[model samples]
Target: MGKMKRILYFRHDKIGDFVLAWPALAMLKRALPEASIEVFVTPVVASLAEACPYVDHIILDTGDDKAIRAQIAERNYDGIVMARSQVRTMFLVRGLGVPYVVAPKLHWYQYCYKHRVNIQMGEGEPVWRKGCRLTERLLRDNDIPIPSLPTQYWDLSAERPKWQAFYQKQADSQLVFVHAGTGGSSGSLPTSHFVSLIRQIHEQTEQPCQFVLTYSGEERKLAEEIHQALADTPVNVALAPPLDKLVDFAKSLVAADMFIAGSTGPLHLAGLHDVPTVGFYAARRSAVHVKWQTLSQAHKRLSFTPPPGRRDGRNMALVDVDLAASKVAAFLNQDQGK
Candidate 1:
C-alpha cells in the first residue's frame, strides 16, 4: 500500500527470456509508476535491459557474489523481486536485507531438474501460459498488477535507417525475415537445412521474394552460409547486426511481412511485434518454451522430436525445415493476398 520508491527486478536469463519479460516489466511500471525499476541480468543480456522502456538501471552479472552483495547493499533497495529462482540469486537477496523478497517456491533440486529436463524452462514462461504462472503469482504476491499479455504497437518512423534501406531495396515485393539461431550455443538449424529451405522457397516463388538472414555473435557463420547458398538465386540474404540503438527489438519486427526462424530470440521478437512467425522447435525442449504474444493467431509454431526408437544420447533432434518453410511461405502468401 505504501509508495515503492526503488525496486529490483532480477532476471538473469538470455536475450529471449529478457524480451519475453518485457510485458511483465511494462505492467510493473504501470503498477508502480513512481518506482525506479532496475534489472539484474547476465552480462550477455545486460544491453537489452538497458534498452527496455521500463528499466531504469542494469546490473551486469560478473560471477562475483561478494561484489553483487556489496552493490545491492549500497543501493538500499525498497524491495527485491527475483524473477529467476537461482540459488545464487536467493543467496544474494537474503544478504541484501530488503524489506520484501519474492521468488518461486520450487526447491533448488526441482528447479535444476526442470531446467535439465527442458532448456525451455531456463528461458521463462511456457506455452498456454503454464510456465509463467509462477511469474504471475510472484507479481500478485507482491501486490503488483499483472500486465496484459501480447502487447502490440508499431512505429515506422522510429525504425533504424538501415532497415529502411533494406525495405526500399525490395521495391514492391513482400519481405520475409528468416532467423536461424537461438540464444544458446546450439539448438539452431544447420546451414545445409537453412539452404535447402531457402532454395525451396526461392524456386516456388520464382525469386520474387527477399530473404533476410539474421545472426548474433558466433552465429554469424550460419548467416554467411545462407548468403552463399542464395548467391546465384534471386533471394537476398544478409546478416542483421544486433540493433543496440532500438529501445525494443520487438518494435523492429513489426515492419516485416513474416518471420521464420529456429527457436530463438528473434522468433519471440516477432511475436512481441505481432508479426506472424513460423518457428522450428527442437526436441530437446517442449513447445511451451517458445514465447509468443497470445494475440498472434498468424503464427505457426512446430516442435520436431526424433521417434522413440531413434532417440540418441544427445537431447538434440532434427526438425523438418521443409515443412516449416512451406508453412512460412503459405502464411506470407495469405498475408500478401489480403
Candidate 2:
C-alpha cells in the first residue's frame, strides 16, 4: 500500500445496499482526493453508480470472473474493500495482485482479507455507517485522515429543479410519494395495505396535496388496484410517470415534499435529497429499525417496524396502518401549504 494512487471498492449487490454505500464511497474519494477510486457493481445499479460524483470509474460485474479479474489486475489497485461479501468475490480477490483486501468479519469465507472489520450486523447503527466505518478503519490504519461525510453524493442539480418547478405551480401543493415495491427483498406490505394507507393520507392530510404511487413491473397490477380503489376519492392518486432509466426516478425524488416506502432502494433514493421519508420495516428483517433508516434529516423521517417476540409482529398484514397514517397526516399538516 505504498503511496497508494488507486483503490477498488466492491459492492456488487442489491439496490438499497448499494445506494447506502454511496456515503462510504464519498468518504473514500474525499480523503484520497488524488487517488483514482473505482467501484465494482452489478448492472441493476449501474445507472446510479454512474450518477455518483465520487468514483471515477465503474466496473460492471457481469458474472464473468476471469474478465473481471483481468480488469482488476490491470487497474493496479492498491487495495480493495469487500463491502458486500459474496462467494464469487471471495475467490475473485484471493491470490489477486491487489496489495490489501478489506471486508466485514462475518462470513465463513472471510479470512482472506488483511483488514477485517467486525460490522455488528444487528446493532442499531445504520448499514451505511458500518460501510463508512470500514472506510474509516482502512484510512486511519494507514494514517489517512477520514473526512466527514458529505450532505449528499448523488447529484440531482439538473433533475431536481425540473420536478420542483412542477410542484410549485399548485400553490404549495405537497407532493407525496408512495412506493409499493420491495425490489425482491422481504418484509413488504401488500398493495392492499398501501391502498388503505394512501386513502388515509388523502382523507387525513391537512392541506391539498398530490400523491404519486410508484411500483415496478411486477407490482403494476397492485398499483392499478390501488389506483382503482382511490379513483373516486377527493385526493388524486397518479402512477409515477414511467421513466426510461432508474437514475431518472432517483433524480425525481428531490422534488418530493414527502416520500413513503418500505425499507427499499427508492426510499434510500429519497434520502439522497434529504426528502422526508416514512419507511415500513418488518421485525423479521431485524427491522434494526435504526439500521435501515433513510438518509434524510433526522426529524423528517419516520419508521414503522413490527415488534419482536409477538406472533403478529412478524406478519406484514398485522402492521398498524392507522397509526402510520395519523402520524403522516400530522406531519403533512406541518407543511407550509398555501
**lDDT per residue as tens, model 2, 84-173:** 887788887787767777888877888767789988765566778878878888898778888987665665666766886654425546
Q: Tell me each candidate's TM-score.
A: 0.76, 0.92
Distance from true location, Cα of 238 in model 1, Å: 3.8
TM-score of 1: 0.76
Q: Pick the candidate with the highest TM-score.
A: 2
Clash tally, candidates in order = 1, 0
User: lDDT tens string, model 1, 147-231?
Assistant: 6643452234356345646445366555677776764522556667878887777666533666677666666777887788778
lDDT of 1: 0.61
- Please report how far candidate 1 places residue 217 from its true position, in Å: 3.6
